[model samples]
Target: MSFLYFDNNATSRMDDEVLQAMLPYLQETYGNASSVQHKLGRAANTAIERARIDLADRLGSTPKEIYFTSGATESISTVLKGIAQAYNRKGKHIITCKTEHKAVLATCESLGKQGYEITYLDVDAQGNIDLEDLRKAIRADSILVSLMSANNETGVLHPIEKIANICQEKDVLFFCDATQHVGKLPIDLQEVAIDILCLSAHKFHGPKGIGALFIRRKSKPIQIPSLVTGGNQEHGLRGGTYAVPQIVGMGEAVKRFEFHSQIETIRDYFESELQQHIEEATVHARGTLRIPNTSNVLIKHVRSTELMTKVPEMALSSGSACVSGSRDPSHVLKAMGMDDEDVFCSSRFSFSKYTTNDDIDLAIQQIKRAVTQIREASPIWQMYKEGLI
Candidate 1:
């Protein structure tokens, strides 16, 4: 049997166009972008700047405002830490939600240890933070508010425009990690007024290890401190040689791609079929506004690990890829008030532009079979059937 891939939120397969654009940089145009002496080096530098302009335009930013980083993880760390270090005198308080990616959560935790007061706002059962709570959390000492544009595991989108507005009203810097929703959704930073935004290209069919950050200037320029200091790369904010091939690929992917409505239809069909086949299946964030390709489902009495084992051909994830090795329940779900069992039984299925209708049909069948088998052998299911509660 042929396999089907549904873990696009974890990482997407690179598009052929992006790959073709990167080939020249790898095979022949291998020159240091910082070395402007030779023709080849100048060529590399010019290529990087062009890529910068491509990404900047998509974000409604100028080339000078866009700073390339390793990926979202690095970008998040840089933004959070940079704000913390640069504006400690203004205030060391930072506000963020509980369902954010580990990149933001972990960085905030680290900053907390360094004497910064970090306020973690609570979310509703639907995995969305309350704007009122956000308003209450912002104190006079608060200098920054970091939030994700979308939840990676559940594909639950946050209201960024409103969030940015609140940040502006409070005179706090707004930072958004746009890793999962950048290419999958229509984003115009010029209209949104986000102070700092970060996204990884790999999440959107670009090369891995290449991402960019958009920094907005409030009257004067925003001075973000450096984490990786060695050379003058990334405008002295981040140092090290540029990954020219990855940068080129990222530029092509971002500039050329648009969100596919067909994928959303397929994802909704898959969710409906799962609910029809397995009555116990509960879809997380189904009613909320979300990215088109993502669907996270929880089937009672069926552990995600067992489901994966029962249907080895289905490529899905138990939780975020970043927490694959850990045995803990999803922090994102836990923050939403879900019990441990709900988190463990939930599986995330994210489609891509390449995913077909046939793929969704096959995946639904595999998931139905897996859930049936898992529940049949589960003592909890049997106990519930006998009214042991």
Candidate 2:
């Protein structure tokens, strides 16, 4: 049986247009972007610059402000560590939320070991951080605020505009990890004053292993020393030869990006059908705003792993793919006040621009069957049915 893909929050399918655009760079124009001496090198350099301009234009930034990296993880590490090093004189404290991606949380954890103070703000049951808590969290020693625009597991959206405004008023630099939101939703940097932002192309129908970082340079010219230093590439910020094909693919992806509302419709339909058919099914963060492509749901008395095992033909996950191997409950859901059992019962069914209603219908069918099978075999499910604790 063919497997259905519903794990778009982990990574999106690359666009065919992006692939076509990248072919020349990968096959023939392969050269060191730093070495613009030969034709191939110049071609590579020009392609990279063009890609930079395209990405910057999409994000409402200038070409000078954009820097490429291996992916969002590297971008997150570079900014967190570089800022911690460069701005330690100003302050050693950084503020973020508990529901952030592991990229931010792990980097903050590492910073904590280095004597830097890190404040992890709390999220509500709906996976939203209180604005007042954010306001109070900013202190004299607070130099940076790192938050994500969307939760990887629940697809819960942060009020980024308001958060950015608060950071601006408090005179603290704000960094937004927009990896899941960038290509799927609309984000205007000029309207939202985020000082530093990072996005991975793989999250948005571009090639894997390539991403971009946008550091605001117009208003105050935020500065941080290079974390990956070797030679003068990315204006001495990031070093090493650029992946020309990946860069080209990212550019094409950005240029061809369009937010499909149909995915949201299909997602809502999937949730509604599941809830109507499956016993005690619930959608987490359903009351809150989310990216159009994701739906995190739970069917009571059904363990997510067991259900997934029964339905091997469908692509689903309990939480972030980065930590999928861990047996621990999802930290994102746990931070949202879900217990270990509830976390294990929940599954994420993210959609994509390519996802269709028929695909959702088939996934729902498989999920219903698998969930029923898992629940039938579960003693806890039997106990629940018998009204026993």
Candidate 3:
């Protein structure tokens, strides 16, 4: 049986171009970027620098502002911990949303344990942050504000530009997690006025284990205590041997995605067609603005896990893969004011540039068939027929 992949939000398959770009570094140009005396070290360092330049160009930032990391998790951790440590003298307070990724939420939780004050701003029914609440949350002692550009589960786009403006006016540092939106949506740091941003390459068509963090040069430099203190890599912020091949792969991936206009068009087509053809399916569009490649649907009478179990050929998820094992409903949905039933019935289907229209059609058919079967067998549906649903 052929299988369809619709989980790009969780992770994307590596592109051939990116794989080819990484080949030399993995096989021949293998050397630690920290070793300065050897020719191999110079070659590895050159690849890393080139990759940084490519990523920075895509974000409309200078190469000097980018710092490499293992993934978005580490990038976020570094920013939260780094800024808190570096600027604690100024303030020991941070602000974030209740719906942020576990990486951000967990980091804030850890900081709270260490006596830092944290305020988690609430979201509206559409999963958008309240600017009024944000304004009220800001304090004289608030040093940093972290928010995501787009939600990983809901695909809801946040008001980063507005938030950044507020942060600027308030003279507080802003950090953005753009992991879900970087390649799928256009981002210009100059326009957004974000002080710091984080992204993981695997969310696009790049290999895993490589990501970047962007820090504004004008902001007071963070004397962030190192997370991995050792041989003075990544401007002495993160100290570890650089993974040259993965960095090269990420650079090539960004370059390709930056030029791919057709990807967005195809994604829109898939979303439009799926909404048109899937009758009675409550399509979750994540408010007015969202990344083009994602669509989360709540099939009213079917549990997401049960539906996926019946149709095993499609690669999809209920929500963030990080929270999959939990029996609790998606915190994102709860924050958006979705009831328990709607939350349990929802599933996420994400697309990629490589996905074909035929794949979309097939997946829809499979989904329709599965829902029909599940609803037919569901006691809840029977009760609904008796006016009890």
Which regions of candidate 2 fall more than 4 Å away from where they truly are?
none
How much is the lDDT of residue 283 in candidate 1?
Answer: 94
Clashing pairs in 2: none
lDDT of 3: 0.87
Q: Which stretches of candidate 3 lie over 4 Å from their true place?
A: 259-279
Candidates in order have lDDT scores of 0.90, 0.90, 0.87
Instruction: Give a tens-digit lDDT track for model 2, residues 114-137.
Output: 999999999999999999999999
lDDT for 250 (candidate 2): 95
RMSD for each of the candidates:
1.0, 1.0, 1.7
What is the per-residue lDDT of model 3 for residues 1-389, given as tens digits with 9 covering 90 to 100? Answer: 67999899999999999999999988898988878689999999998999999999999999999999999999888889988998999899999999999899999999999999999988877778889899889999999999999989878898899999999899898999999989988899968899989999999999999999888888456455677788778878788889899999999999987535665566677667766765556667545677777778887768999988988999999999888999999988888888999899999888887788788778878878888889889898779667886
> How does candidate 2 fare on TM-score?
0.98
lDDT of 1: 0.90
TM-score of 1: 0.98
